[model samples]
Target: MGHIIDISHHQDPTKMNYDKLSAQLDLVIVRTQYGSRVIDKHYKTHHREFQKRGIPTAAYAWVRGISLNDMKVEAIDFYQRTKEFNPTFWFLDVEEESMKDMRAGVSAYVRALRNCGAKKVGIYVGHHLYKKFNLNLNEVDAIWIPHYGKNNGQVTSQPSFPCDIHQYTDKGRLEGYSGYLDLNRLMGTKPLEFFTGKEVVKVDKKDEIKKDKPSDWAKEAWEWAKKEGFLDGTRPKEPVTREELAVVLQRLVKKLG
Candidate 1:
């Protein structure tokens, strides 16, 4: 649905105009850090400039570690540094060096990130590397695949797996960019909320507020949901299971339709 691009220090930020690029691209993912301590030199600059130009941005941290504890350290460091930027999506760059134990390593990194309260965590890997490691792709919120064509950067063949974003070519040329740049394609349409948390909307508190009301702000939403048959017939105080929540969502979609 939209044109997306990924960049790091490898591409010179000094040469790229954030305003022009923002006009041309829908989204951007910048490299924030590597391992635990090494921050990308251009990360803060890119993040700030992109935001100034009103461009939506996300970030990825390169995963580095030999063990689970090492991965946890890297996750903590990553969360501390990039949490300030508040990327629309946070991804762990999983490449050959980080895939030592393969499945367990990936699991450890994802778990550490979740523990650190990172939202919308995703994985970035190549097709060959994914198949080689037999990665459990379900561990993250989204999958980013980098598969160039038969030759390097040609983009002749399609990736064999379902992916949310595909890095199709590394030989892309964009205005304001000095040389070739990495290009990505967003496969399906998703709102910015799919990556970022939804915006909080303020609602009025009227005389109809009840003693066991959810939240003063959520009361209106709850009443609408209940009236539309999106809720089970249970009382509002009852807890919802994962299964019940799913059914409610399905019904809400049909109601909206």
Candidate 2:
């Protein structure tokens, strides 16, 4: 299995060797923000550097909201900043006792993320508080529970509860880094694609053609535009920009002239 690790400003990018780290990592989940405020200083660099090396990446935000409204605000802030990166998943790192009703607060956070168009959402709960918090797990697409068996830089025992991903060690040592890194493992029968949302599917050629080709209603006009040298017959299913429309209009005007 490919190694997975999470990082924040704690793992200084300037000191860390990304060339070695990127070769070993299958996924990298970077912390986006610490709450509604205080965006992680190295988040953008971490995301870009890993992604540049062709490793899939995800984003997580430490949940520090005290009220339900605060939870929503934090979620919006997390999405707004990290959405441009198009992370495979957005995770809520709920570790501290922020609110009286954490269940409701966590649910609100998930809902707000969904409202802002976040498709794949997950939660990372401290293993000790797994049962104590009684978080609304149903709201998320995946659950991540941390169980550092001895925190001895090795995976000793698995998390007691069922989860999509497990953070087995915080003091884990890897070949690329000299310091401690949070190392994770994919649990149970779920494949890596389940978390990355990159599941491969077999498609029939006929169905592919039907999806890519122009619809019957637009076929005649589409052909006419192409034949008349006004429009290029490519990317028919893609959106048209103002610049492309202007060019098309110019071509049509010249043709008529």
Candidate 3:
């Protein structure tokens, strides 16, 4: 409804200027730098500042790659640290240029966070990538789109609301980086989770495995939940059972109608 400003130290905090940002934003997602990037460093200092200011906040990372390995590292670290702050949601800043042909792995990072017990997670993508990746909107959260495209909403081809936040113009000419950051009011959302169905590829990581494979219908149900915003992420466990499978199928069919 108000705004969801993504705060990051790497971007220059003074550029944010909380006095101005607070006035324009409702939710502040500070980059805790949770991922496995030891080269540079960041902390939850901004999250504390926002909390003191009484702003609803969360944390995220500049996710570089979309592999299960990349997610596993960041997911474990981000969750372990944020047990204290306990923000509203988590995000994988799916930046452009960095994400190329990794569409299939988009769900990897999200799944990792889910496995670590992250309740709410979402993507921060602009128009360029949303279109570039040929996104499956039904399986993900609303886009944190930042664009000046004349017909921005036209391309998505869904009912115009595909985009949640619009970083209308970065480097706000007026506030000097205190630009307009719009967001859709998040409703009925929860933390994100991740579970793996793929084979245990690593010799050392054989512990995490679902003995039986999932049926076609069970996998279909998963896809459905993801698209409908019911599923947060995946975890490693035995395949969905016939009884559990029946319940999900019935629910989905009812929802479809």
Candidate 4:
């Protein structure tokens, strides 16, 4: 049972008394960039302010990719900006029809972040885009879905996935800020440290962080794939086709069974 908030350049950190707001929130996700070139004006301000108050922080990059190659480039740019922040989590903000091939574009973006050593990469998407892209969400660590209601900060239709976080309202009123803010709830029991990349004891804060070790299911699938020669003894730094993916999945399933 935790409360979280997302802020962009729209939310003025200087105007809001963070000391007062910190009491009401456990974590903050700041918007760091919009695509490859444009940096969000308020990102550094909000990030520093939130950390100054000892609130856990993460980051999201608003993606605008016109094609798979474009998305990969944008992702690399995003990774460079956010990697310095050492946020417990990082998310790709997916909206609009910017990507020409939605599936390949999205997949490339996620893979790029992983390659950049983002330990806890996630996706921020609405239900419509989720289904439209038929996104293979298992590739990422978290899913943040947004659903707002007609009334003040109330959510009418809940997201279908057991979301790690839900942005329930955009019209939320807070005491320290004059304008409405995006409000979220963390659905899982993992505490703020879990999201902040601080849970691991041995890692140095400044070093390039790798994603947490794979889950038992993922390990099993990997072992099965390797045993059956499905991986072909190479790790590709490039994207794989859907047909190739289907064959691998089918082979892994049969081997596991």
Clashing pairs in 1: 149-155
How far is 70's C-alpha from truth in model 4 (Å)? 1.2
C-alpha lDDT (0 to 100) for residue 20 of candidate 3: 58
Q: Please, what is the whole-model Cα lDDT of each candidate in the order they appear?
A: 0.78, 0.91, 0.57, 0.79
Per-residue lDDT over 1-257 for candidate 4, one digit per residue giving the tens place of the 0 to 100 score: 44688999888766888888877777889998888778988888888888888888899989899988898898888878777667888898988778666777888999988888888888898767777877767898888888775637766557776677778889888767888889987666655566765565666653422233334657776566567878753443335789989888987788789
lDDT of 3 by residue, 53-124 (tens): 777777767666646576567667777777588877776667644445556555766677778887767677
- RMSD of every candidate to native, in Å, equals 14.0, 8.1, 19.0, 19.5
Q: What is candidate 1's local distance difference test score? A: 0.78
Question: For residue 218, what is the lDDT in candidate 2?
Answer: 95
Which ranges in model 2 have alpha carbons more than 4 Å from their true place?
201-257
Tell how far residue 147 is off in model 3, in angstroms: 1.2
Q: Rank candidates by TM-score, best first.
A: 2, 4, 1, 3
Q: What would the TM-scores of all predictions be?
A: 0.71, 0.77, 0.55, 0.72
**Better-scoring candidate (TM-score), 2 or 3:** 2
Q: Is candidate 2 or candidate 4 better by lDDT?
A: 2
The number of the candidate with the highest TM-score is 2
Pairs in clash, predicted candidate 4: 88-195, 88-196
